[model samples]
Target chain A: MTGQSPIVYPGRMSRWEPQARERLVRAAVELFDEHGYDSTTVVQIAQRAGLTKSTFFRHFPDKREVLFAGQDVLCELLAGGIDAAPDEATPLSAVAAGLEAAAGNFTPELHAIGPALRAVVESNSDLREREALKHHSFADAMTLALRRRGIADPAAGLAAWLGVLAFTDAYACWIDPACDQELTALLRLKLRELRAAISSLD
Target chain B: MTGQSPIVYPGRMSRWEPQARERLVRAAVELFDEHGYDSTTVVQIAQRAGLTKSTFFRHFPDKREVLFAGQDVLCELLAGGIDAAPDEATPLSAVAAGLEAAAGNFTPELHAIGPALRAVVESNSDLREREALKHHSFADAMTLALRRRGIADPAAGLAAWLGVLAFTDAYACWIDPACDQELTALLRLKLRELRAAISSLD
Candidate 1:
């Protein structure tokens, strides 16, 4: 699905010309949403964005990259959020702060982004594989955050990965009709449930 | 990359035709490993197995399905192993029994499989996706087993997934030249470490 509208931000946020970036993302999400990922093209997105092909290329390398325009920013926020947590915070606690930051970063304007993103991601095999790769990247980042607190073990990597899954699953549940909890509360609840499940194993 | 050669029963197993299954798996793995997945042909695999392409088709529906030749047997064995565990056993204990049964199912005859299977799966996106789907299927089977035991939350799905990952990560580590732990021991050690990691969070 095409992302948000092409808002022509004035001054400071004019890094790449917000209007063009916004148009590209918006057109991409719409195109992906309507026609599906494999069928969508950069040319069509550019056409829908009222821009030349060159302008679209200047804003995004390809159509798929347009949907993930803010991934780097999100990753930075997550990393910073985790690092800023208290030194004595548990791994999941640090990860919870990071996840909360991530949730907050997605403003109300981007509320529909989750399913739109998942639709495009699930339809393509390369994109799905990359989703797994991105998860691995996030887990690696979380592990580095834990290492800063002197938590050393191969288990650090596994725990970070499990933490991500718990948070992601909670987010999924939050968006589901069956779940009544808000995203933040749902994450805490899922983490508690996950902890209980794991603890009961021993 | 290929599974075990079929076990030749003295008389009782003769009706099962282990030799035919072994020939099919061996030929398929050899072709998939050497020529690569896309480049390899069912005709070639059949020729390598001294059979017709129709014979290969009889054994497998498609080229990718050959990679999962014994999945049904593995899933059955895994479910049965979990179900056979004592009612007093903890969830982790039950899951561990299933994992151990799976490991036992893939014997020394399949020792060279880890990297070869990984290579094929990694090289082909469809096969790579199939890996996750297969894991999900196994998780579902495990979840059903847990439900039969009156486990309250189907969050057992998450636990099943994490348990599988722990098994996979530990197995991967065991096969890595840098790791000194035996495969079986590493499985238990990883589970022990996982228990510690979760408890530490609480």
Candidate 2:
């Protein structure tokens, strides 16, 4: 599905026009939130976004993709951050750097959407299963990144898993309506708490 | 579909018996291994077990349930281990104790079945997704157990996640034909490596 919109491209939009994609995602989330995920259709999402069905198809293969489109970008951000870490940095520190870089992308606007997104996912068993796989993929990416840094097995894998745990736990706290702390701060707190917990183990 | 065999029973077999359930599981796994998971049916499984479809239903609600029937027992064993840990143990130590207790249950016979079990799970995306949820459930159970011991937020959650990671990683290695170490030893090694990895982080 391809289409040429009548609107001319500006400097910002010329590189890669994301307006249509953004609109589709917003529309999909809103509709999924209002109606159930199974009840909502791609045609309805495209219509809600004021875009043609072709445009929606161009951005996402199906309705599920709207919620998960960021996974690849986030994975790259995490890996790139780890690759960019200082040579002397330990595996976990490099992982922390990657997590920090990823956290930078979760702006307040994204955090605001967390509850509704979580609700939608939690409502559907399929969505919940997909989300779990996505989380596992994140851990897998981190493990490979650590391996690239010359970290060995067990250590590399464990560090990656721990980093994921910190990120997931911090995000859970950061998304709470009552949480006043920034995500970066929460991430740091989580990492520290993890270290303390491990240290306390005999 | 019920039948009374000619064999005499002990006191335990005279009452609620698990021999039929065990037979069903063995038959199911054998059938799933021989035939593909999708192709295998309840009737076939029951017949292989020398029972009836009604008997299979009495044990497992469905074919998928046969694969996941161990989850509840494993969860309870983990929670019980945590609860039985010495009161003075740290959160992570308590978690380690729980993991060790669970590892004790993975006998040589069980380890021998791991490859086949893993094959069955890996062949189906739905099974893999359910396995991930089961893992998350284990972590949740451990977290609740840790909280019961008066451990705080991030520490309790992190410790629980780490415990799961250790158990999962250890089991993966332990299932390998090349692995010569015991499950308990591998688990300890994994936990130590995790501790070292986190300790090295600055």
Candidate 3:
């Protein structure tokens, strides 16, 4: 929760980090696929991305972060959206708004690279763990926001977990080659389905 | 999920692993508190536990594995419990049964050293990631078990995540100085409370 979070804020990405981050991720994944994950180096990724090693670290904490580049900004958007949700909104709507906010961070490049990134991630256990950590971070960010909204212990945490499931499902759809829906619409639908499924579990 | 999981099975612990594991954890935490996590060595931990270095490795995959001993066994119990739940049991009950299976791994020695282990874990980020991974592993274990029980994608994953939150809450209480209930009881109550709170979220 402390060391792992959004390294930069919203609008900060407008300052040049986003394009650099994208290049780094694309370069890192290319290196991973071509040279094997273990054989690839940050220096190589930076060289490939046409950025310095320091610039690579400036955008990503490590090489594994290549596929997970937009996470920090995504997390910040989640909390910010939740925080900015209208007064008297239910937790579900608040989370949905957060998802909508996060949807803005999903670029056409991210969507285009999704399949390849998934392939590279699925090929490695370390990358998978980092992926899990990323989802966990999203939940943590949402949980904190929900708590701030006066949602109590199990409920805030539960809603946050549900938000993560929704986010995961929506991302899965958004990445599919056949899917045409925007992430915002998919997230709202997935979250609504989660809300419905909550009652079905009993 | 593969590289980071319970290293041993249930009855497998009968053959000198549990005692060795306990000794190793106690020793490791002691060393972590005294010499700091970076300064501690596997050989030194083995020395403090009065066992060979290989014996320490036999019980744990790495130094970080020391604080998270018995996780593999707990995961097995979770899956086993879910598998053994009655044919008509609801997913909630099935998860409860899984948690009940996991409760057997919480030894008095674990309870006694809970605070120290937690303190040691809280002191470091890498260890915290390891701890988070351990919880994520538990959810993975349960999700697989629920899938075996005919539960579908988002439902299985969501149910497993709820079980984790309850397990987390129950563990928090179990580690408290004032908590006297069995982990099984605490887990059941927590899970039931989660069920009730699910509807309250909206």
Q: Highest DockQ, which number?
A: 3
**Cand. 2 Cα-lDDT:** 0.81
**Local error of candidate 3 at residue B112 (angstroms):** 1.5
List native contact recovery per candidate, as a fraction of 1.
0.26, 0.62, 0.56
Top candidate on lDDT is 3
Instruction: Give one digit per residue, the lDDT tens place, for model 1 in B57-140.
Output: 657887788787767776776678778889997777777777777766665545556567677887876676576666656766
Task: State model 1's lDDT.
Answer: 0.70
Against the native complex, each candidate's DockQ, computed on alpha carbons, is 0.23, 0.45, 0.53
| Candidate 2 chain A lowest-lDDT run of ten | A8-17
Give the range of the ten consecutive residues with the poorest summed lDDT in model 3 chain A: A9-18
Model 3 clashing residue pairs (backbone): A6-A72, B6-B72
What lDDT tens digits, residue by residue, belong to model 2 across residues B136-202?
A: 8888899999899988876777788778888888888999888889998998888777767666555
User: Model 3: how far is B192 from its true place, Å?
Assistant: 2.3
lDDT, candidate 2, A102-177, per-residue tens: 9878866678778888889999977887788778778888889988988887677777777888888898888889
Q: Write the per-residue lDDT of candidate 3 for residues A1-202, one digit (tens) a residue.
A: 3555446666424354557777888888888888988999999999999877877877677888777777888999999999999988888889988889999988898898887788788898667767887888999999999999998888888988899989989999999999999999999889888887787677
Worst 10 residues of 3 chain B by lDDT: B9-18
On the 0 to 100 scale, the lDDT of residue B68 in model 2 is 75
Superposed by TM-score, candidate 2 places the C-alpha of residue B142 at a distance from the truth, in angstroms, of: 0.9
